[model samples]
Target chain A: MDMIRRTVLKSAGATGVVAGLLATGMLKPTLAYADDWNKAAFEAKNMDGALDGIGAKGAADNKDLLVKAPEIAENGAVVPVDVTSNIPNTTSIAFLIAKNPSPLAAQFEFSNGAVADVSVRLKFAETSIVRVVAKADGKFYSAQREVKVTAGGCGG
Target chain B: MADPMKIRAQMKGDVAEVRVLMSHAMETGTRKEADGKLVPAHHIQNMTVALNGKTVIAGQIAGSVSKNPVFGFKVKGAKAGDKVAVSWIDNKGDKRTDEAAVA
Candidate 1:
């Protein structure tokens, strides 16, 4: 089980060099990526800002959305989270960590008959509520699950 | 050039299940190094998945994602041998794209 998750781990030294270059103004990131990344939402500082940035401030809670995560995460570094929306015509799904510095962790827009299901790993600073919000037929619905982080607990 | 992304695509019934592992540091820009200097933020900001050259999943990822992020998604109407491509661009302007055939 651990081997599966650990498979992606590799030396990050190359990325560190890129970071240094960007910091020193040696390399410039193209503005072309701005159209795809949601800067407003990802840079939002608070929960309210995050919700507003995603345009889900008044989202209604729904049971059709499923958020699967470990009740207690032994490690906060790589907590696996899976989300599935049974609601018809789900156009998008967004994952938000209630207490994260930016709250809005990730968001995916689905189209061309793509299923509104996704699995991803997230880093948690501490125990926090994992919120899943989905948009279907122009209406926003949400569901949340609390994941407890046990410090020093072993994870397989 | 950036490291190649590991991509796997398989047909689960009629839907194609695509999973990808991107190589990144996903720095939060708030962490302090041993020298007490802030680590600059460097994370995947944009990602996209395409089935047979058609867009299926478009996403925005942040530093909150774990390092070497793994993502799984399913696409409908995909058949065996169909092409699946995954691509991403980080905040530092680094980009990577890899493709796999659905089996």
Candidate 2:
């Protein structure tokens, strides 16, 4: 633990120097390391809007895209969801919840021979269908599974 | 500034299984404080995973993700001792990057 903390501190210091360089314009910011945050999709109020934001509104349903999640969750704050896409040339995967205030949860773009399987922890506002969408060969495919949350993740 | 992420990478046959646990508050603006004041949204906005300095996965997320988010991924063509780096930039412009070697 001590070693880990020390390492963290060392990295933090290094980042601090990097930040300083960036602030002083010594290091030019490059687009290579930056990715655009999908604002329209993430802030969408409904699932359909979220789907549209990600250009998956009319995505075809495919069984090859598998969504594995608990059927019932006691706590909505941290529900584990796993996705695997068997589609050939799969390039990206996205998660959308039907009942969250903003339905879009996350989206991941894969490349360079990465596997199309991922596991992530998400929050569900209530009972909702968690949708997984995969983009392959310029086409989109999706799958969904329902999860019942006894306790709400979003606090009132 | 944010806490460092915990990353683990292991060779599972021909693939490298990488798991990352990030420390974050992930506070949504909807939630209120004890005094009933709405908490400002603070969460990870974007993340990237790199293998030996090459990006393999790029992600964008929202506050709907749970606090201290955990994620797992699989990378192909990776061998033991190869570097795997994971980094994220949050809504508040806070960022953290951590790396691990496939074992």
Q: TM-score per candidate, in order? A: 0.88, 0.85
| Candidate 1 CAPRI level | medium
Top of the candidates by lDDT: 2
Alpha-carbon DockQ of candidate 1: 0.63
- Per-residue error for B58 in candidate 1, Å, reads 0.2
Q: Which candidate achieves the best TM-score against the true structure?
A: 1
Question: In candidate 1, which residue pairs get closer than 3 Å at backbone N, Cα or C atoms, i.e. clash?
Answer: none
> DockQ, in order, for the candidates?
0.63, 0.45
lDDT of 2 by residue, A1-156 (tens): 344334334434754654553464423233223237777788889989999999998999998998899998988899999999999999999999999999999999999868999999999988899999999999999999999887545432
Deviation in Å, model 1, residue A48 alpha carbon:
1.4
**In model 2, how large is the Cα lDDT of residue A33?**
32
For model 2, what share of native contacts is present?
Answer: 0.81
* Candidate 2 local lDDT, B1-103, one digit each (tens): 6888899999999999999999999986688899999897888888999999999999998999999999999999999999999999875567788998989
lDDT of 2 at A46: 92
